[model samples]
Target: MQAVRGVLAVFVLALVGIVSGGKMISDFPKLSVQQMCELMPADTSFLRPHTCNYWVRCPANNTSLEEGTCAAGLNYNKDLGRCTMAANVDCPYSKDSISTTDNLCANETDGTFLADNSSNDCKGYILCKARRENKSNCPNNLIFNPTTRSCVYTNQYRCPVNGAKTKSPACLSLPNNTRLANDEHCEKYYICVDDILYERECSDQSAYDVVLGRCVSALNATCYSTAKLPPPENTFCTSMGKPKVGYFADDESCSHYYICGDTVNGKHDTNPQHLQCGQGLYFDYEKLSCRERLNVRCTLDRCADTSLTYVNVLGDCQAYARCSGGATVGSGRCPADYYFDERSQGCTPVNHNYVACAA
Candidate 1:
């Protein structure tokens, strides 16, 4: 009887072990909160613990198995496990947790971005188009400096005016019909019109009268030099007493006649007299009077030596007078069209026909 009972006990223990193993396998926990939190389902709506776990409670609300639980906490919905907020509502995922797209930019178009896909959203993630920061869009005749991020105009052609090939940022017209060239620098061709100075483009020389100071056809236009000369024919003459006779003077003698010192009229006369001429004048023995020598005071007719001319293009007179025929005038010659032919040494017009006398 003792052997039979021991054997029966062993058989009973083996059967109990089999039953316990089967039960443990069937009653195993379906899911844990830690596992549910980490699982990312294909459909966010299926993220509830009821769907994912066989035995665990809801992970989001910590509810029992009977009450559905959301995995996304307060952001979660019973039907949709994913977190979402109503339009214009503040949300944790947003920059300001708001349903607006204001803080984000959209990625579209070169060098451009969009803040929102739909106009309804005031704020969202912005998308931006990627571009090289160093790229530029400068055209010819314009240089772009990356460091400055500015386009600079250049004068590579060395033109006198309007030479810049690039279009001007601002169009500027010449004031008072001013002349200009095709160079970068606007060269001015100025003329006196109706007593008023006017400027024009240098290339439009034909459209202006340089002499009349008016706008006229450039064809056959008279080009004038800035030079001027004083009037002609005003003079003074004084005779140095007939060749000093014997280089002495006598009170009783009508005119003291000295030894022949100089020749006059091919005669060995004892009179050693010399003739004295005033400024702008030379003695004319035939007339026995001083006459104007145009070449004497006129810069145009004066000697070719540039230093002798009284005035230059800039209208400045030389500091000293010009010497001619071994005689020195007290003052320099007047500019072209002006004359100082008289003993007064004042400047006057060369001819009323060509130029009006200046006051």
Candidate 2:
């Protein structure tokens, strides 16, 4: 009866310790090799099986058990009663199950890793478990600028002029030299200068037209000028190249012609030289002299077949005809104070007073 009572008392103590989640022995003595190793069965998790590196019977006389921790890089299998390699210890879940060089959690199989929406914090790997992105967010109404590498508001940023807008909600650069018409005035226009739009008024009571690039009179506006013509070799010169002599009107008066001579000492003579046809007479190349502009008969010649020439009539140098392809197609004109001479086969000054047919 005494032995049974002692056994019953020991069992009752063990049962109480197990049920109350209390350690029966406050401090267990360290175990050495060749000693009994034991593990408390109640202390193990049901999901993850507990392992014991070394176990021992408390006091070396009781049946109650105690467990010791596993060694580094080793895990204990309670069923096998021996320490094993950690790689061989298979857990039910793969979370926190791997090691690596750049990141210890690189091989961790916690959750989905979103590479496109991830932050720089996980530089080499990811450990997010919620399936949402772990992105570093910018402040309210601000966007990340990759060039500046900072968050900036759209309104505060000064984008480049005439550049395409960026993807990160930044301000767009407007095109340079854009023009707009003013609503209040016909003569006034708007021009974008250096990305700033401002009103520009045309001088001299002219209406604005973008195609004409200037203002003109609403009724008597004449936007036509020889200045609008492009110069030779893309240069804005008075004259250049072969066929040494050419003519341009001196202003809107059409009373004088600016003789554009070829390169003399490597420079063009753009200034108009004085030449006059006396009153009651107009220059006529057909007669090769100053004759009346009206009732003038120009005799056609075979020399005109291969060359082009012009004789002035009705007061304009540009008003002329093509002398080519075996026929004089239409009436020709000369410069303001000059006329074509069939004898010379070129333009001559009327002030020379030399007649093609002289006595």
Candidate 3:
């Protein structure tokens, strides 16, 4: 009877264990089919009968497979899982779209072509279709020159010059419309166009004033090596021989322009005009001048670079803290009667006197 009882008791315990195990399994949430596929091995390759093999670029070191698609100017190749030029695709060809020739790109029209797909983690090449046939791995410092049909150095290059014994200074190529000073001649400067340098002489034989960055009579020329300066309205002592009255802008509010009045005891009296946009209003640069602060577009990354004073929604020039890498760095504020200059990134007193803006 005891043996019979023991067997019955074991059977009852086993039944209880089975029932609890089933409940635990049902309690766990199940993943969907898509999730299951994604969780599979990364470098997975499979085949469909009579079709191309499918592959996920799950290299051992890669954490995830890259998105599969060709760039806008390229066509995808299903067999190799790569992208090629529009003309290289094996699909239906459009005769009008491209002109194919075996002349090694010499007869090809002027354009740019990519040799391989860049969307994936694979190397690629850029080909130039120019009068002279050439191929290159256009690195960061080099760009393809269509005119020459070759890759040329960007920052450094040898300008073509006629035969002369005295070599010319290594001409620094600049963008079009950019002006640069000519160290050799004070009455002339240089401008760049089409990666070619052109010398420009000041009209009337005037000297190029470095401070003003323009041509002026030699007698009136005052060169400044740096661009940082007080307001353009402020007359340089060397130019006027004395301080003069005019409105100048500091690093602060535009509505609050500064005025430099007659010199007092050989010192210019710089004072603020104390212009007001309202109690909560701050000045804003609408275009070149200041108005009430408005909702101007700004990126968070740039706005956080340094401490700044900006017009809030309520129009007050409130202090903002500096940030580094999206983290706060420090905080600061301008003194009374002074505003922060966004250009110079410094606090400037409103103009009421002629003390130097730096002072």
Candidate 4:
């Protein structure tokens, strides 16, 4: 009994030493592992929340359990179900489940995470600013990707931002039969139909409409410009496997263009410099510069045939569409003084300033 009392006295000294050090006992990170490891049922192995190096296994009928730490330079990946190199696994967080939503920020430092609410788990997220909760919802066509920490296309990320909300309350409350712009590549977009995501790419390099959520010319649509366009190899400025230095126009949008080389040194930059012209100016790809938007023309399937050079705009005499290599590039409308001679063509006065002819 005296030996036991001596051991207890040592423990009390250690406790006093820790308490006197000025940090609360609860402030130690291992306290969570200690508390949760003991509470888990025997014979179960589990990961400690928010940590990548520590894992705990409950021993049979034992009150105490020891946490196992991963070897040096390795992190635990729950998806791989094992510990591996940090490169092999993406350790966004060690555990998929978060604390109860009532206090989503509980035990969480100053950071943001998915709200993943039970009743409406589609697009909500909670931001932890100054350790205070600021809950907000993503737009109707988007869903929160906890991994990316951004609101993405509804079809790109299946709803239920976190795993806790998945299949728990039947399913997510995401919008059905909706269109969403791909946040990465301007050429790609998505459609969510009946809770399933369908990925799509534009036939041409058209940008997805930000507001209407449909394919529109880059000149017209506000494509999500987050640097995910086709690489330089596939872009218009690429030649002999290297990007050339110049201003390159987007295929569809008259207003948007990109600068492909260094401005200061004339050396080529790694990525094409995406840019936009003023509101009314369109990028003239052939002239390799921006010009006033005047005669760009378009109609349903008017420029489908590559063999045709000019197609008259139906019903409109002033507007015509210019097709080159089977795609409409600009408007072929005659100048105000010179009307399109239908013996020449009747232009619809749409999306074009003809590069082939003077304005």
Best by lDDT: 4
> Which candidate number has the best TM-score?
4
For model 2, residues 1-359, the per-residue Cα lDDT tens digits are 77446544543343333221211111111113112122111222111111223332232333344546667887554334455787885432234322101122234454433221122211111223332212223434443343543344555344333343111100001123434333324465545344233446676445665334456665543222211211223222343453335544333222223455566776555443544344423345334354532333322332232343543323332334445563556765567777555434466665323332221
Residues 201-263 of candidate 1 have per-residue lDDT tens digits of 434324333333333444543323221122221111112533322232222221121223544
Looking at model 3, report the run of 10 residues with the lowest lDDT sum: 166-175
TM-score-best of 1 and 3: 3
Q: Worst ten-residue run, lDDT, model 4?
A: 166-175
Write down the TM-score for model 4.
0.25
Clashing pairs in 2: 37-55, 37-56, 38-55, 38-56, 285-340, 311-333, 311-334, 312-333, 312-334
A best-first ranking of the candidates according to their lDDT comes to 4, 3, 2, 1
- In angstroms, how far off is 170's CA in candidate 3? 7.6
How many pairs of residues collide in each model? Answer: 52, 9, 16, 22
Roughly what TM-score does model 2 have, to 2 decimal places? 0.16
Candidate 1 vs candidate 3: the lDDT winner is 3
lDDT of predicted model 2: 0.35
**Is 2 or 4 the stronger prediction by TM-score?**
4
lDDT of 3 at 32: 30
Residue 311 C-alpha lDDT in model 4? 55
Q: How much is 69 displaced in model 4, in angstroms? A: 14
TM-scores across all candidates? 0.13, 0.16, 0.16, 0.25
Q: What C-alpha lDDT does candidate 1 achieve relative to the native structure?
A: 0.29
